[model samples]
Target: MRQDHASCNISVGSADLDLDGYGNIMAQSQQIFDCGEPLALDIDEKILLHGTSWKNANSIVCEGFDNRMCQNAFYGAGVYFACAACKSHQYTCNQHKKCCSCKCQRTVIIARVALGDSYVATETRKKERRPPVRSGSSGTYDSIVVKPGLIKGHHKPNQVHQEYVIFDREQAYPAFVVEYTL
Candidate 1:
């Protein structure tokens, strides 16, 4: 039996009713909602019950699986902007607050590329003019170049760069170009 609360909130859980073999409600109690606050639930994953809170919260981190039980949110200009890294299925347009309508991860990728993939290349080479302090640190170094591509010997973590046009000494810009940077 489905009982509507004050609004559209439909509370269901072990405390709300006693379920029998035939999916029948055998009893009712004072408690409601598997957990009072928002939560994530996985199949074959057990959730210990008490009053209105979860006994084992597991972790605050939200893996791909945890996103299922919660509503999807876009990159908002609120507290979400404070995060060092926030991956949403929606593009984060700083200039405009309008969120691009997207369905899956690929949609987000296309949106991101359209919004900020220009001046960006995915492949880079670090030609060592001279050997490094270590022995095996010379020759051409291959790297996945991000924006503002690093040169001969200047690369750091979390540093973005802008990629310019391509040029080959004696041939075209290579036979193929593969981009995989994010």
Candidate 2:
């Protein structure tokens, strides 16, 4: 059924609308407004909302399911830098600020030298003369040349010195070097 009216009269109380946390208006009443109708409301209303002022926000913290939703920011020097989680290390230059690059090491023998293993030598032995003199006589000694004794000694021995290079993961070039004596 259709009713013909010259003008439509309606009254909306203060309870008709609800304001959300951000002060956005939410309609509560089911009053329908027809096209080409002069509408009327009853009360003058203003609602308080939240997070409307920029000065109220303190810290920048964002979280989301995927990488597209969350934003990590470095707020400093009046600069609000916002970036995705994947690119945060590059944006903040944190990748270059490393404490130690090398996590593993490998030892390699660079050089080895060999010296004389053993040597033989000779010595002079002093022999005392026959002591037949009485209590007042001093004993005379004679120097005799002796054959080379079986003296055993070693010279500058061969040594195995190793030079080690440290690397991180599969890095092609070494980060540092360490020397070891074996």
**lDDT by residue (tens digit), candidate 1, 1-182:** 11222132323222111121123222221122223422222111111111000111112112111212222222111111010112221223332233443232221111000010111223332332211221232221111112433333334543232211111111111111112212
Clashes of 2: 0
Per residue, candidate 2 scores C-alpha lDDT tens digits across 1-182 of 00111122222222212211123222321122112222222221211111101111111111111112123211111111111111111222213322223332222211111100101112111121221222232321111111122312312232111111101111111111222221
Q: Report lDDT (CA) for all predictions.
A: 0.19, 0.17
Best by TM-score: 1
Where model 1 places Cα greater than 4 Å from the true spot, the runs are 1-123, 128-154, 168-182
lDDT of 2 at 11: 23
Give the per-residue Cα lDDT of candidate 2 at 146.
Answer: 14
